[model samples]
Target chain A: MVATGTWITQPVAFTSYQVTLGRIALVGLVALGLTAVILMGELDLSVASTLAVAGVVMASIDNLALGIIAALVVGLLIGAANAFLVVVVGINSFIATLGMLFLLRGLAFVISDEEPVRLSNIDAGISFGKPLIGEFTPRILLFIFTFIVMHLFLTRVRVGREFYAVGGNRQAARDAGIPVRRRIFTGFMISGLVAAGSGVINALERTAADPTAGSTVLLSSFAAAIVGGILLNGGRGSVFGTLLGATSLGILQVALTLSVVQVDVQNIIIGSVLFIAVISDPNSIRAVSGSVRSFLRGGSVLSKPSVDPKEATNNG
Target chain B: MTSEASGEATTTSEAAARTADLGDRGGADPDIKRRKLHVLEQMANRGIFFFTAALVLIAALFIDGFASLENITDVFHRAAPIGIVAVGMTFVVISANYLDLSVVAQVATAAVVLIGVSNNSNIPMAIGLALLIALAYGIVNGVAVGVFKANAVIVTLSTTFIGLGLLRWASGGSIYFGPSDGPIRSFGTTEIGPFPLSMIVLVVIAIGLHFLLNRTTFGFLLKSYGSNRNATRLAGVNTALVVVGAFLISALGSTIGGFVLAAFSNTAVSAMSSGFDFEALAAIIVGGTSVFGGKGSVLRTLLGVVFVSVLTNIMVLSGLGFGYQQMAIGALIAAAVSVDALARRAAGK
Candidate 1:
């Protein structure tokens, strides 16, 4: 950020930082939900589209509170529908969510009539959009609060621990008498609820609901979550890591914007970063570190260390 | 420990006994009932074929211009590129790595490369360069997935974005128009007695792929890898090679599809083939190809291609907007996948 500020004008850098931070706070909310679903060995590609739907719903409704409630309800319904297709109907989560992604995006387009819905009332918009403190928007504060609550919920709560078990191994979790299906169902619902919250925040921040708003959020949020150390395969990650990841991405975006890099180039950079992050994940890091240590100890890194079953069994 | 061992042994023996009983019942009164269920499952597996035939018949009976030879030919022409891509996708899916989302990006890249290169070079050189570019992209994906064991969806998805970005950057955000005087253009525009030349190319490619998949040892290894990678590896198959081959084949198909599409439209735009990967996937899934891998047929994908084409044609004829069309496709994808899941469940797979 200092480099960006130095490269560009300070005012422009500050504005870019503020805008990117605000935008990614909303994205961070979605990423938090995505982290949970991904940790549970499932994916919800429809989060972005669900956000679009919520945005549209919130934008279309006259009453602010009513719109917010409606959007949340719509999100929950979408989540339930996804759970039904995945858990009850037995469709693979990837395929089911992919379908939902398109379905919901299309629905958003239909609902919004392919136009951006602007929030007409300034007072209500200000309440949601204005910063609660200096340089900290309501959305950003909500994001931080949600992050803390979710962190506690996942780390401290019993059901949250069960989510780890289920994601780590569904059969094992089932054998252990966990309500695996219900846990998975709830994970998706939380994802849905968070997605809707982000959508509302987005609508408020922009003071309008654009039908195409969330199209790019899916990949960006995934990138953020993955960079934050969330495994795509499931069962390990944290909201705090995701918070840092989203912040880094926001900073990266701001930096790129200041650098005048084209959007396409920015996409390439993001894609590369995501690839690198996934490849250099914790397991990979451990393997590399072990091999390096072995090499330093004057042992051939490629040579397999002989293992005694007795020793292994005793350790276990 | 002793009790746990005994408990596991008993469960295994009981399972064995149950299988023995099932085998015995196969020749008894239950056999007929089982046979009926088997037949039902077969029908469900072939549901899309039946559905397509029924849809065509219904369209013929009801919709205007639906039964016309000209319109039918047009549908086939329109289906050709995606069908070709779907054929390749069938292999990738059957290999159990799931869908290749990069195909659309590959197609666009191929198209742009073909046009951009052909402008400065000969037609043959341009085509070769475009294919080489696509093959390189395939190698990158294959190595990352096959060698590094990266998640297929994430890797391919990242590649998709990267490919799109690189193509856009390279092209300077401009669309490329194919030159008028080449085999590529002729292939795109020419027809052979009521059929588009491109459709004929699609048929030839389909036949070739069917032979490769069903008649070759390589195909067997590919399917085996998809079914059980560990077992295949234990059986002395190079699983990485199989995976790489599948990705290459997928990229090859996308390249061809891109080339044909660009030629047909006489233009190469960065986003022209956006969402095509999903469309090919839909066709592949609709054709009864298991998304989980180890079971699928190119012929089934062919049927799926036609089915989707006819459905889209009918929808467009009915004057449905793009939004509704997207919704319908999504619903179709969900329905097709659900049917597959139901069939798999019924079959105890």
Candidate 2:
């Protein structure tokens, strides 16, 4: 998709493609955290809201270090609150985080007074986004470093692998003596921390914190995670996949801009692609095929319920 | 070990003796006590009612102009649109299909289509076309979620983008009804003996849906399906049809809401209903509908809508801005669901 869009632009500069990586890094930072939480069979819809809240905090403070620390602490508290709701209070992760999303979004608006907050140290903020080495800015380096560290955590760490175990089967994991709740709590905390970091980077790049900044990024991060093969069902996926997903999405956006495609049209394309990706699940595929076969065989089209792959395999 | 075993035996025997003592005293006394306990339990179960009542009392006492009849009517008028959409959302949530995030976009489509088509054609035709488009959206969403068994949240999210994008591209951003004096505008603003027409529509729809949910076979099947999908399917219920029906009702609600909103504003734009979907969902969840599904009522949703609208109204009257209102509502959703979860756990559900 990127190549085709770039091909139409006449001068297909590789440099433009490299520039797109910076945007991908922004998405990657958030998506990496999302990937971790999803691996634990939980969703964190509050990531974007937390990002906005953190960005607003970062923007309000005059000193860079203090601002970043305050932002991280805010993110950590929000994550801990989500953990208390989901892990301790036993609310569904999706609903709890969704509630947090709304609360944080509202808090962002309240703190910022529904207006954009410009960073006090404009030069420092701008420098963060400036390329330091061969098309890699400080923000991009942070994202890459976070991705690498997350990759190692999930792969090499014992506690990290237990997130998969907990998600795959909670009862069985408990029976096996895994600290399931603790793992989930840790996952959300890291997710919150990483999302805050992403917010800081975004504010640095833009030099302002807008109350509505994270609204669009919320869905985009999900798209990135899903497109990179992170199953919504959890107990599977990797940060590496999210990185690739973010990269492709960034490239697609860049390509569309290069080809002068309208924003609405771009949305249509992206939505359609997401729809296709969601339905392309193997379980959905089998269900579709089974229904088609039954229809062809003159059996009742809607009679047979869609067979759950996990259940079907278990039965077999 | 022996002492612990004897202690357990003693506890059981003492409990048995107490039961016998109660039986010996009188069945009537126990029955009255049990009845009182049952009433207390019922009240506890209806926690949302108390929460809403508390908010109303607080608002009435603290906020100026809150206790007035005009402000009360204004609250209902404000709630009408969300109530309409949330009534549909009740079914979707009860059926365990989760949220229809695309309703926001579907609403915009209806508004845009109504104005655009009305200007090009006739008003009635525009209404029909707008509803038809919404129905098409519902069908696509229903098939994806019901037939293909895709995740409801993601499927609806995708449809939101698709619907919004298509509407924006076709309408070229915004469209106007192009007339100041029309029947549609009157329909939006009309009042019958101090009651807004939209509020009446909401009430009628709510009553109709109450019956549909409590008295109909489809409602029974929908509830059962939500409670346990595999069990419902095993019982030969067309679970997919029930889900599709739920989505259809939701679509119908969105379309009607759009029509009302557009008529009131005399213009249609993609951003008009931006936060409406979440607002409706919040009302539904706040009204004591279990997010887990299989149990809810349109009546509860009605109270929820009223509660949310009243709270926002009170905030406005008290010099609070939209930001504070959003925060309060957001906090309410989390608190409501957390309380529900705790109650469910206590009940050992």
Candidate 3:
């Protein structure tokens, strides 16, 4: 889609292509973290709010290193808080994180006084995003680096593989001696940290931290994850798929922008795209198609589920 | 807060029964820890009432004007729309579908359809058409989640974007204002013996839904399904129908809320009902509706709605900004759910 767009938007230089990649890198960072959290059979709806708070906290600081450190710490704290709410308190993950989302968003507004916090040293902040090679700036490099590391971590590391086990069947995993709570904690914390990283990079790129900084992209991150095949039911999908999803979404976004598509129209398209992705889930496709088959045969539109609920429960 | 009136009947009857049960087991264990745990469990079970009482007393004492009948009625009037929405949410949550995130969009869409079409044509037909559209939205969600077995959260989230986007496109992202001195606007503010019409509508809906939830066969099947879907299915129930019914009820609530909200302001905008989704959920959860499903009551949810309204009203009276108010509500949700979880754990449930 991106290549097709580049072809139409004539004089698409290498730098322009890199700009698209740069955009992908930013969204990819957040999607990557989201994918990990979803993989653990839990969710962190607070990521965008965490990003906003982190960005504001970072921009409010004067020292360069300290500002970045402060932002990362803020992310970790929010992530830890989320972990505590879900793991220790035993509140449902989505609801707990939903509360966190509102709380952090309110915190951001309160601290920033409902205004954007400007970076004290614009020159220092701008340098952080400066291109290191052929328009591949530090931001892009960090995204790539993190992607490679996360890919290896999930695929190769023993503990990383355990995350899937934890998400797939938490009780069974616990019975199998996997540290379920720890894995869930790690998943949320990583998501928080990565979300903060995205926030910091965004702050540097924009040279200010708006209280509403990541609200717009929050849905997009979820879209990217869904498109990438990260199951919401958890314990499935890979980081690489999220990267592909993010990149494609990035290209589509640029294409839409170049074509002058209105924001509402773009939202419709994205919503439709998300719908298609969810509908295409293999399990649901089988169920829906089975119902269709039954309907065609003059049976009820929804045929009785083959497994008797009583028998299923008894077996369990 | 109608809870003051309703809470008395519910808390006393419920508490008396609970304490009677405790008396039956009286002095047997004599374990300090066990006795203390029992008291905490009782508190948790009846916590919403106690919480509301404490908040009301504190607010009445500390916040000037909070004790006034006018201010109290204003809070009830303010809670009516969201209370309606929360009543519908009660079904969805009890069924363990988690949430209907599309309520915000559903409300806006209904409002836009109601006022937009009414201005162009007539009010009665506009009401019918708006309800039809809302039902259609409900059906799509119902089929997707019930028949296809799709994740409820993701399906509703996508529908929210789609519904709102389509609404914005259709309405050109503009606010639809009803005629000045329109009958609908007057209906919104019409008072019957000091009770606003909207509040009266809410009470009627609540009473009807309360009976439906407790007395109807569908309601029984819904609770059974929510408590244990597979078990209900084994009992030869069509779980899909029950799930679809739940979503339809939710959409109906949103439609009525839309009518009340847009009528109150004489304007319909897509963003008018923003944050309603969470607010309704917050009320349900605080009302002691288990997030796990199969355990809730419509009357209890009403109390939850009033509790939230009074809290917000007190915050406004104290001159707190919107940010702080949001934070307080957010914290309340987390704390409420956590307390419920802890109490359940203690009771060995």
Candidate 4:
């Protein structure tokens, strides 16, 4: 909160807290979905783009009720498509999502004709863009709801455990009789749905759904997952970690921007952190370090029997 | 290294295939894999060139000014960054690790640091600080990748954001310091002859990288390290150092690229190299470098970058507009990546 006067600072602290709350509500829910996918050993760069498409679709609809349903349906369909390709069809998650990203972005550009879609709405004497009750807005509520739901799904549900197994080790998970395919599908779908929900919130806040909404968020999501101490290769990240990641990222950007640091430098810092974290991962380092020692000590070909089919001749 | 191992294993499999005494060996799994690989290898060797050439031809027919000397120079020059980036990635890929996505940000980080420091401080001190910061970044990534052994993609992706954000924050998220900055200007306006200085820089880096990859024990070890990382380790090589060194080299490439981009713009921006990763990566993959690592070439990457640059130039000149441009380029990337993936399968055979 950065307050020298503590809670006695009154209005200033209150505004800061409200702003933070507003940011979390807007970004946290989708980040939660992204956390799920990352936990399953994948990155979803297209989540932002997914949010854009779903929000645009919802905003474009005539009836609010039908629009909400349509958005969810579209999100599910897109998620399913991604899951089918990535989890089931075995396409690399990043590439598959990359394609989806371009496709969705292009579609957004086409539909919006490069214009932002403004959804007109207001309730209880407050505009959609403004905070309700000191930033305890509907978006904030949705964020909390999504977080609790995902936490439950991941921790309390059988399906969630299966998701972890698939990420931890596909072969072993299969060996243990896990329905790997379904878990993966669900993972991707969850990613899509939440991203879409994030998009809806984004649209509501701006009152104008941006076609490029998720175009830039790819970096943010990755930053969140990594800084939150979530491992990229799956089976090692947490939703809470993602929350922290998203929060820290938001704070860093805001703090830097507010301080006279230029915005671009902020980007560099985020990217650099991600890279460093990746390189310093323990398992990867051990594997690499162990290999170097082996290569030096015995000059024997290091072979993992489960994987290496070429070890015999490589030594020679 | 892994290629050698895989190559040897395949030969054995080939022998087994021959010994089986059935032409329908193609009917079975290994045989099918081999058959597929045979096709892929053929594509890797020559098909890549044809693909690039054909893309050039298609651009010429469809795009105006596409075949001009000006266009050719522009295309090649534009590709220089990716060419440089690919040279670094080729090492990492060959070493059986991941390519550095943070490279995209590294370019900007280096440029901004180099230009920013030079603009603000004494030249030597600025240069020293720039290099110091970049090396710190490299070590951070290297330690994580080499010491901690994280997946290259996530690590680099995270750093990409950090680096880009840092650059923007430092530079005010805008085109910075324009050509007035002398040291930064060299990265852009300098030239050895009719060629832009950036092109010459590309040539220098390419030659150096090629030498590093093709002629050195380090290169062989890198290849070995990637192909069968375990085998290389068991062979008692310091796989950690090698992998870390791979990141250092990749960062070096990004530094060079940053230098050149600084040269090109005479100013640095946060998004200067924003989309360079996919471009460099596309070139590497399109050049027939394996996404799974341990099989690709710089020459092919050069060609791949040239091909992409040429295609983009042609598309721009042709005036196909934005949507068509994106669609066509997207299609091309997918096609190239698909081909490269297919080639890996072929090489596997």
TM-score of each: 0.87, 0.89, 0.89, 0.78
Per-residue lDDT of model 1, residues A246-305, tens digit only: 877777777687879999998998888777776677665664565456447675321221
DockQ, per model, reads: 0.28, 0.34, 0.37, 0.30
Q: Which ten residues in a row have the lowest lDDT in candidate 1 chain A?
A: A305-314
Q: Model 4 misses residue A299 by how many Å?
A: 13
Q: Compared with the true structure, what per-residue lDDT tens digits does model 2 show for residues B1-349?
A: 4454334334323432443333223212234433233332344346556666677767766676776656665776678878888987788888887789999998888877777788788898998887778678778888888778888888888889888888888878865654677777787778774468988888777767766666567667777888899898666565677787778778888888888778767788888888787789888887767788887777778777867887788889988887787788779878878877777776657
Candidate 2 yields a Cα-based lDDT of 0.78
lDDT top scorer: 3
Model 2: per-residue lDDT, tens digit, A193-312? 999988888898899988888776777788888888877777778887788778777777777767788889888877876787777766677867875675576744334333232122
Q: Best-fitting candidate, measured by DockQ?
A: 3
Error of 3 at A200 (Å): 1.4
Candidate 4 residues B228-299, lDDT tens each? 777776565656667766777777777778777776767777677866776676666666666556655665
> What value of lDDT does candidate 1 attain over all alpha carbons?
0.78
Could you give the candidate ranking by DockQ, starting with the highest?
A: 3, 2, 4, 1
- lDDT tens readout by residue for model 1, B139-192: 888766765666778788888888899989988879888777777788788876
